[model samples]
Target: MINCDQTLSISNGKMKVAIEGCCHNQLEEIYKTLEHIENGENIKIDLLLICGDFETIRNTEDFNSMSVPAKYRTLGSFYKYYTGECKVPYPTLFVGGNHEVMSYLWELYYGGWVCENIYFLGYAGVVNFGGLRIGGLSGIYNDRHYDLGHHETLPYNTSTVRSAYHMRKYDAFKLAQIKQPLDIFLSHDWPRKITNFGKLDDLLHIKPYLRQDIESGKLGSAACEELLFKLKPRYWFAAHHHVKFPAIVYHDERTSSIYQSEEMNSKTIKNPDEINIDIDEDLENPDEINIDSTTSQPHISEDERRDQIPCTKFLALDKCLPGREFLQILDFPEANGQLEFSYDEEWLAITKATHEFLNLSFNAVSLPRESVIQSKIDPELRWIRENISQKAVGLVIPHNFQPTAPAYGEQQTFILQKPFKNPQTEAFTRLLNMSNKINPDGQSRPQE
Candidate 1:
């Protein structure tokens, strides 16, 4: 059986680590890359973070169960790790992406061991690693099913398979409840319009083709944007689009006002005996509040204030491909084990009260669709619906524009490549070669 008792601790010094764009069943290549860095530079990676598309197919059964087209289905390297044919060389943590073995990941919905030394972060989760509080939300955003719960089950049919990738409202609600600061936040897709914050010219220069999507404001996830605005984590890492992009998000008074408003509103409940919620106070009203410069000023040094103001640094890397800027190493000070793994009390109370008021059970699987729709009119549920419904503002797309269609259809032709030349296979070959080179003694060394 895989070992799940690995201790997590980080010393006072800066933690050196490796980050990958997407692990599309390329675990071996990722290990080899880290191994190369470790052997060549004499540096140890404390952890490895994969943004998503971590296809952990264990065998033919898992391969058949995956939601990919029949022709695309093939068992990758995960089979070895699952069966103990090979073991992960280092501690690895990942979130689910669009293309994943959902059946396997769904079994560990609350986050648990995928195999020895590898972890799936669940639908949404916060885990402490050597004092650093790493929070992540798995799955991308799809507005059509944003409010829907995870009602899909195994042996997924065509519709359910697609639904598996969409982010659920419950997970998003739980994440918003986190009051503590997060050291890092990981997601599969970039927060919508995050590009507006920094170095846009550089990004556009590199990936000029994205100008249409960026300009049209159809690029990323709006739900992620709301969470970023609310939580303001130190560093946000994502992958889906497969490009190396970076941005600095400024924590303005607006974000602070929204948070403070929620905190204040939640406290205004005088008679705890009743579950009466004020819809007006609960919904975010950005224009109603004025920033009071005097009392609102944080008690911190100027440098610290500056650091906390334009605080969040957003980094997105390209997909795992050789000679690409898909891998990155960064340093972070030890969190000193100060991280706490708990839900925000207020959020939990609100979620609980709302459910109780609606006479809805946790997961509410048995509730009728009509009852679920009618429950939204309740004061507390209404507050949740209104508050989380903030869509991307000012992003206008041409009505004639079809995202899936080629812009210049007459001039463009698409070709499907053979399986041998597939990028995943290439990555596997690279990993195999690296492993062989590293194991000159012909003995496999467990990555730590």
Candidate 2:
């Protein structure tokens, strides 16, 4: 699920919320895990939320330069399989991380499409799912602040700088803009706390990088901290702080109202009316002792339990065949790669959509010869060509006969159907115009 919110009324009297962390690029694995969890809980989830970093790309060029086949094979497969086939219990919500934002940026620049169900909540977005109001701040933290802070490192900034700082800053800005009281907050990074900023020594069992930031008064998302100081949501599901050092700062109505104030000679950051900070605890796990939910804290269930509620499943039969195995073995003739089994049709659509959705048509040029089999061989392609008569190569096919050792006066040809590269919209025009064009009556493309 990219991001979803659905109301789930549980018999246990608790509003069950399911939030997932940054998936990066492993959509299939994440979905499989969710499927397992749902099966075990015996309860349908109310909402499924995802904090950002959905895609994995280090830079813009790497994202833009991806081959069409690779993009279709990886992300295309995931989208097609999960969105098209998987059975998810709740309404899923998606938030953008640095990766998602950068991906969209690439789309704007290079022209590719993102998935429809996988919503790209730019800096921040809010959704109503399963009776819970969920808000999210995606992307790197403090991107605006980082932009302001590190103006000198202009041209090329490393992930460390962007991931921890700039994106954090941007998230904070987004947090301030959210007006309603949210039942949940799915943020990529941790909120501000003493423990969040510690030293980097692995043996010290401390989050050293965050510690350095805190020492410099820069730990956590100021946006998040400021928002907590303002709204103080009931639950904050954070993922960027992967190392597991849970710190909870209690806040009262009074603390929630006071955004900032100046007192005495220097500055005094007063705690909320009744506040306590405990470190190195996993709030979700029962064994971590330092922090307890019972002591002037929010109510927690004895177990991470969710009630299974009846859900509505949307089906698109024309595009997909539910319960039936829709499998294909794709072979790339140009590359020295072997075909492997994979799943997900949403991924395929996303890859193809990206080509047209982002309007990459102007810059990209494909001839009939380059058409690959996957796009042409599938039932979808045949339907398009025959029904719509939309001329353009959706698939590639090799011409029969050995091309390397052609007999004298014999010409070999490859059947092609993509739109002509020039102004004229013609299918198989390039092949027909070839100097060694073979007779159509005697020649045929290799059968699948």
Candidate 3:
């Protein structure tokens, strides 16, 4: 529970409402739940933020791209919304999770409207709503393919479909460049070791099965952890683990590894006096640093260094399940002005670099003439082949290899069950009940 006094002071008198959780193809249920909160409880929600696993399957064709078991493939309620048979009841925004229609999401890699009022945050994006800055990183972390470029093409093959969920390094890099304050941040997976900030005993009591993973530190994402440390947003939300857990991260105590790496790189200039490094001229003083002669590094006192001490409240909700704790309504202050979307410049640069290296024609080997004409006409594609394809000299695919599923061991089996019930749902329900009792009338309560 967050204290109402503290939250209201920062909200600037604007009522920004949010419903945090995974939709899991339950758009109608989510809408009905919002209606219940508004009409029944007399609470009006302004913004709906679904963490992920939304399953925005627009039609039957999208079903083929979903990473689900063959028998479970079908267009869900998203078809109705996509066809304009129904409309989103409110302003809705979402990110991609491990389980989704990658084909449809990939088409909007830069972030775009899925329907009238529904927006997908693309691979990674930042947008302003009601004057509040919101940032998001879609997909989960996978170490194996984290550094790889997005080479997966249209009409995705079996392996590429699964590969689409792995978080890329470029997306994380783009997120790192946001130097402004973020009111809220969203991701499909939790930051690694975030459970340590909250009551682990309480969490374990509800979902005893997770003890092994929690103790072994085998849960959540390292990439997300780095971003949390760097950004330190006011509120962080996630859902893939399907458990409603709240953790407050104090940024002052945690130093970002990215900053440390940069410091190390800057200090690694061996024999600086011997090298003629080009130094950018400062407007006030052109000779800020002498390029002809090396200068000793300046030492600064502790007070001169930048300090990041803001606290971030991290909350993860369960997947949509009846009688479960899957939704929350929190008030945010109004935005400073009209809302607008901005693409990450670092991400755009990465996209161009990736296109330079991996954008080869599909028919390069089978149809030479057609490939040549297509390449010649498309300057971007030609640049990719001429500059990047030659560098992939010894690339080889493992024989009879299959990509690993996102869920591990027992969790994988659990997801395959006919009537699947995520293990974290029950514990989350208990936690929510406890919170409700403390606040009773749905008012904010102080966090312990």
Which window of 10 residues has the lowest lDDT sum in candidate 2?
A: 310-319
- Collision pairs in model 3: 130-335, 131-335, 131-336
Cα TM-score per model = 0.63, 0.43, 0.63
Residues 136-176 of candidate 3 have per-residue lDDT tens digits of 89998887777777656445678877877778866776576
lDDT of 2 by residue, 1-33 (tens): 111111111223334444455555655545554
Higher-scoring candidate on lDDT, 2 or 3: 3
Ranking by TM-score: 3, 1, 2
Question: Which of the predicted structures, 1 or 2, would earn the higher lDDT when compared with the native?
Answer: 1
lDDT of each: 0.58, 0.34, 0.58
Question: Which regions in candidate 3 have their CA more than 4 angstroms from the true location?
Answer: 1-13, 254-309, 334-336, 339-448
Backbone clashes (count) for model 2 = 58
Alpha-carbon shift of residue 333 in model 2 (angstroms): 55
Q: What global local distance difference test value does model 1 have? A: 0.58
TM-score of 3: 0.63
Which candidate, 2 or 3, would have the higher TM-score against the true structure? 3
